[model samples]
Target: MAKRAPGLGAVQETMLITLHARARCGDEAAARLVEAIDYDFAPMQRNAGATELFHVLRCAALDEWTRQFLAECPHGTVVELGAGLSTRADRLDNGTAHWCYVDLPDATELRRALLPDGERRRTITGSVLEDGWADAVAADPGPYLFLAEGVLVYLEPAGVRRALTTVATRFPGCRVALDTHGEWIVKRSRGPLTRMAADLVWACEDPKALQDWDLGLTLRESWPLSRPDWVVRRALPRHTRLTLAAVNAFVPRRMTNSRVNLYSVDATG
Candidate 1:
């Protein structure tokens, strides 16, 4: 096992939950990292069934979106905000695109120790609320794709607006892919097995509300967890697919309102 590093904050530690899920789903890189880490994954492992499936499905949707962006802009830059032990760069490298992973200092420290950085791949240590990191990302090629995956929900509403506004202003015409929790989901996410110590703070009932914020964002697509796009649905196991179908048929929409959203940054922002 690798040497244990200093403890991560409550929110940062949650990355291990997604990491564990990816490992359980047969990701060789994730599995290797899981074996190398010294932390006790027992708590995260206990919630493995549906939670793991949902996590992977969400990742699949984002991967497909990223692939689409790379197809159009092969030399474009991809920046993952609040990236935590994410194997996305490894999984989606197209040889020519630049990849930058940004997160808190300690999380970046741990990630750098475990993941290799190359001429095209690098890590930036900073929070999304800061402006310094944007300059480094802007220095890369154009037509950027910024992914905030499972990061922003922990922030207060004001922070979310500020972060998105910064991205809109700095990288106009770029694409941003992020996940949001509805008010209902945010309320329930505080359950014992769900979020542990990091409670979700922002609650967006509809992604359209983001457009109303005057942040120069135009929602292109939003996929609810219960109803992922065909690409993500077909890739799921039969049992998982059946379960999602049942949820779509029976579960209240409010309960499953969390979504993966894609937005286009207005060029005139």
Candidate 2:
């Protein structure tokens, strides 16, 4: 069993929910690994109505995005920033794409133990705010898709901007997909798991505004977290659904809910 810190491990519990959700849906790989963990994730399901569904949807979106990349550029690189216990590389391996997992030392250590490296996949231990990690991925030639799943919110606005600019400068014409909370979500931003001590420091109401952070980048698309399938929607209260629909209709660009956003940056040459 992997040693775990009590409160600190709380943020990682989000990944556990993803694993459990996937496992129940007959993902053998996710199920096999999830069986080793000893944590009661039931509370997560009860408290967070659509947590599992959102993860499933996000994984599906990322899978398609990754497939599209591999189809175009077989030798393309994929970087998972703040990769906790995500088995995305294993799940979406295209046989030729190189994959890099970047995270803090402890998280990377855990990842190494759970999912050992292979010829095309490796782990880099570092903060996304730093310089060296970008260089680590730079070894692989052109066209990278950086996925920052549950990251970014923990960073201050300046740090987020710096990271984005650094990526654009380093990889040039790379694509980035990340999740961010809105102003309202940030105000009440306690992590979904009670034990997880996540202090979300930045909130962007408009993802398009991120373009101003760096000249090379432009927001490609944004998918609201609440916009799950009908099966998940039925779990939400009727009023909540109505309100979200109303918000979607009124301010299409405003991120009243958390969203996964994609950005494309031009080469800085």
Best by TM-score: 1
Candidate 2 regions exceeding 4 Å error are 1-14, 24-26, 228-256
**Residue range 152-176, candidate 1, lDDT tens digits:** 9889999998899889999999999
Taking all chains together, the TM-score of candidate 2 against the true structure is 0.82
| Cand. 2 Cα-lDDT | 0.73
lDDT of 2 at 191: 28
Q: What Cα-based lDDT does every candidate model obtain?
A: 0.86, 0.73
| Deviation of model 1 at 230, angstroms | 0.7
Clashes of 1: 0
lDDT by residue (tens digit), candidate 2, 130-187:
8789878888766899888867777798888877877888888888888777787777
